[model samples]
Target chain A: MRIKELFINNFRNYKSLHIKPKENLNIFIGDNAQGKTNILEAICFLLQGRSFRTSHEKEIINFDSEQSKLKTELKAYNQNYSIDISLSRTKPKIIKINNSTTSKPELATNFGTIVFTPDQLSIIKGSPKERRRFLDLELASFYPQYKYYFVNYQKVLLQRNNLLKELKEKKQADTFDLLELWDNQLISYGAKILMARMEILKKLIPMAQQIHNQITSDKEKLTIRYRSSLNLNSNFREELIYDQFREVILKNRQQDYLKGQTTVGPHRDDLVFLINNKNITDFGSQGQQRTIILTLKFAIINLWSCELNDVPVLLLDDVFFELDSKRQKYIFDLLNKDVQVFITSTGMANTEKNLINIKKNAIFNVRSGLVCEEEL
Target chain B: MRIKELFINNFRNYKSLHIKPKENLNIFIGDNAQGKTNILEAICFLLQGRSFRTSHEKEIINFDSEQSKLKTELKAYNQNYSIDISLSRTKPKIIKINNSTTSKPELATNFGTIVFTPDQLSIIKGSPKERRRFLDLELASFYPQYKYYFVNYQKVLLQRNNLLKELKEKKQADTFDLLELWDNQLISYGAKILMARMEILKKLIPMAQQIHNQITSDKEKLTIRYRSSLNLNSNFREELIYDQFREVILKNRQQDYLKGQTTVGPHRDDLVFLINNKNITDFGSQGQQRTIILTLKFAIINLWSCELNDVPVLLLDDVFFELDSKRQKYIFDLLNKDVQVFITSTGMANTEKNLINIKKNAIFNVRSGLVCEEEL
Candidate 1:
């Protein structure tokens, strides 16, 4: 999917902005704080119904303004589409697709984008939650149904926790029965999630290995493993669906009460990173960790492309400057003539030759929240 | 920050994968359970020396493997650079910049990125913690010093908590002195964090408001308020240094004992989002919540770009189809021509023309762990 045009009014530093994109390469060049990233953020907002930066919606509006508006035109699979989002102070934002109201799922069916930034580098050095997020998102994109399951599972988890809290406060004897009901629901949904995660991991491992080999010049091997709290033994499917540990559940009740939280289940499960039988989190060096993450991401891209039958857009923030020549060339070569790429840099001089070779690319100048197109 | 080339081996799925990118648009498409997202994740790893996806490094290696390796050849500011990362079963990942080892801070300085994904939508609908993460990350990206402050503050917080736990368990009076010392450290660093956060918010509010207006079609006004547990009257900033809080801290000793944990401080503070004098979290519709998050991200991008003198790359993972056409167009128009763009879609059928028009764009066909170039 590719974006055609973007319009912004009172969004970030841009009071009113309009931009028409080049068919191939589009570059945004500017000094710091010129709102260069804001332009990309605006596009992200329109595509995802969210931003890549902050979490508060109010931050998008001008300090003195009450609302912000964004409009974009897109062309995907030989189709032209437009999306509009209005940020307001008193009500939920309004979203329109092709001049019609739509839900997030419906929107998911129309537009698809992949963004990369420096913060993502943490996928290598950061905590496990970040990795899980990466997996969950990729899964959600390819399997919209996974989004529903994820949301539903989270909702169920929250409700169950709430119920646990209530039971603790009330000091009720029936808490166990109530907990069982919730537990049943949780397990049902949780099982699906666990299975899905396992399945994805299973499929991802070999692909990641292949990518890792190419990136490393065949020096090492890579592996990804899913570690869950539930013991996957006996009749796997039957145990998940029918087996119950009433005693264990009851035993943890008091602990749950004292903690004011549920302490076990899929929520607590984690994905363990192992290299040749050793855990990466406990022993891996910084560089090793970085390679593992890189391999994992490449694996995801390859796996997703394979699954969806099309290439996803590639967004690289300031990462290019961070890599050495060999690694850099590896990534550069991957850009081949197929993927639509977006990169942000302080100056055009900072871009690589391949990145600068876009004859049909559009270049824009961003300064203090204003964006103006520039001739290459 | 544009990627010149990427190479991967035994990371997750690919035993070996190599690709050369188009200067402009590069797309990686695949089916469900494929590894498309993994590819971008690998780039993130190279950039941050960490994974944006998981906490465990070993998980990145392909299952049944002992190690993973990643190499990248990067060109930034017309300079060629290389990065190599090695993941092993028994040691921490290794990072080599131009074949020389470097620290994380140095790496961060060289490579900075901004990532976006659909899960970010939760920043709108999820809890305050999610929002705080959004802010902290933005801060870390623009102000690398903030990362240090954050790390120090966290360490102090953990130490303080540990002291509190000791006090509760030992019921010793002398522990108070030690507690006081930790508290002092906490306040000293905490103050810096508080100040930085406040300053960032101050600069961010105006931009956010403007963006919110555009996204909301000028229907709503948005504001972000930082809520700290400490009473920071002018004198309090000076008076409440760890030493000053001795008495109050002592008074809370009993409660701390009862809780067995630290109960007060900025760590527990929250950021409040308001729209027209109402808290959006409690009252805003789903769409509004999403818009608020979108606005916040835009604000972050603007703030970071302005502060860092560079535009961070934008990462959007399958977020587009979530917004309506108008909103989509808003985003499409917002990606300034100079910014490099990357996006992922299930199929080309849903893509926009502008996205398709990028001069050097390439589309890759991905299927079940295999990636092949799609003729444009």
Candidate 2:
């Protein structure tokens, strides 16, 4: 996949900007807060139908303007496509693919992006919530239906929790049957989500371990295990998982009734990282934690290409300079002809020496929302 | 403050290591997953009587050993002192200052250290929990009694919550009286904590704003506001704050009883960051968020020096390379003769050019749990 042209209007510091990016590498260089990262955020919003930085879509619109607009022209699977998205302060965001109205999952399935930002360092050291988010994002990118299942699961979970609260307050018998209905819906949706997650992890863990070993020169081994609230078995069919989910929900009803919240489900699942049979969060050094995250990125890139038969566009936001020369070289080695990468950096001098060997690349100077493409 | 010598035994991948650091700067260079960060963690543990990376002290012990030991010889206020700490698998950590048994707050008051790690980017983006932690750590470093107040506040809040649970379950008249007693204790401790936080914010906010302006070249203004659970007035005497806290507790008892938990206290307070009067967490770009955190760090360093009449040692863990040359220069400017600094990096070539102007600096090569001092 490649983003050949990007257009933005009234989007985060960018009043009106358009650029023709390189096929392989597009690097945006500027000082701090000079609108370099805003460009990437715009691309991410277009690809994912949401801004990675802020949950409030209205924040992406410029202060003086009432709405923000973004357009991306890309080639994926040897076919041309364009994604157009518009956001307003008081209205819902409108996403159009090839000039027709579309949904978020459709846009994501048509265009895949892998983004790495400094804030994402949480996936390594943060709470279980962060780890679950990382896994869900990865799953949603490749499997569009997973998003539907996830959304339904959350909706059912919310309704179920509210019903629980009502039952605790009113002690109504009819509410108990409604609880059973919501539970079945929750279990069905959750089982699909869990099965998809377990299947993806089955493929992702080994790839991450392999990359981690190569990155560490075979000095370390990385392991990622899914810590589900239910007792999961090796046989991970949807029906079996749904049965296990039902068993747990039945077992947890008394506790859930007391707490007035859904206590066990995919919502409570977590992923744990281990190195050499030790939990990295408690045992590994900071550098080790960083390397594990980096390794996961490589593994995701490889897995996406292997399963989809097309590469995902990579977005690197101020992370290239943070890597050492050896690890940077490993990343560069993976930037083959098929991978289109967009990188935002505060300065180019620190990484220019490493970019000398890349044949197809372009540099753009971003200053106060104005983007000017420069010749190499 | 300057650390003349640092020694570690059986700590995080290091069987034993010792180094004589320079008075101005000490840099440890290594590849990923090496022992560079461990050295800094050891220094932080010695200065603060706790590890900055992990809550589990036993994890610091090397896999082959049963305990970890650290010693630091330093000079502060033109006087020499040594801190010794030992952590065992099944026993509490022991702290000794100048060969006399000491406590954590006492050690922190005598030896102050400011640490910046990549994981701390969460201070700007993660959650209210991270922001409160940033404030509490800063307060505890300078004012030892703040730690005591914070500990007591947490203790009272927990007990108060337990009583609320009991009242919900049993509804005994005796339990209601006990809740009132706990509420009084909670308000007293909570007021001291809230007052201290407000006072510190009054001092720290302006300093952070000044530094943020300078770092951004006057392009942006920074504002920090304390968002306490209580509606506080500007007259921040402990007595007034305590009265307000008590009123709120009284007003919230009904809701607390229904929910079976304490509803309001310092434990629920939060800090909000604004760049140019807009909430940074909601509206700022990633670079803007990162720069705000960097600004807060420089502000804390300045505030500590101004209040204590002595500088604290600064520890940078894999964060230098993440900054551009201009922001890097801002950091270099703060490294005067009085401020001792320790930095860990993955490679020398990326930052070697920046280090050319510093005459009082030392570099060490760290590889696979071993460290060797190298001439700059």
| Model 1 DockQ, alpha carbons vs. true complex | 0.03
Off by over 4 Å in 2: A152-190, A229-231, A238-268, A348-352, B155-187, B228-231, B239-265, B348-359
Each prediction's TM-score versus the true structure: 0.52, 0.89
User: How many clashing residue pairs appear in each of the predictions shown?
Assistant: 290, 0
Q: What is the lDDT of residue A96 in candidate 2?
A: 96
- Residue B316 lDDT in model 1? 50
Q: Could you tell me the fnat of model 2?
A: 0.58
| Model 1 CA deviation exceeding 4 Å by range | A22-25, A121-126, A155-178, A233-264, A274-298, A347-351, A360-365, A370-376, B1-376
lDDT of each: 0.66, 0.82
In model 1 chain A, which range of ten residues has the least summed lDDT?
A238-247
> Cα lDDT for residue B73, model 2?
93
Q: Write the per-residue lDDT of candidate 2 for residues B317-348, one digit (tens) a residue.
A: 98775566666666666664457888888765
lDDT of candidate 2 at residue A59, scale 0 to 100: 75
Q: For residues B206-293, could you state the per-residue lDDT of candidate 1 as single tens digits?
A: 8999877776567678988777665554344433434443444556766765687666665766788888776766444334565676
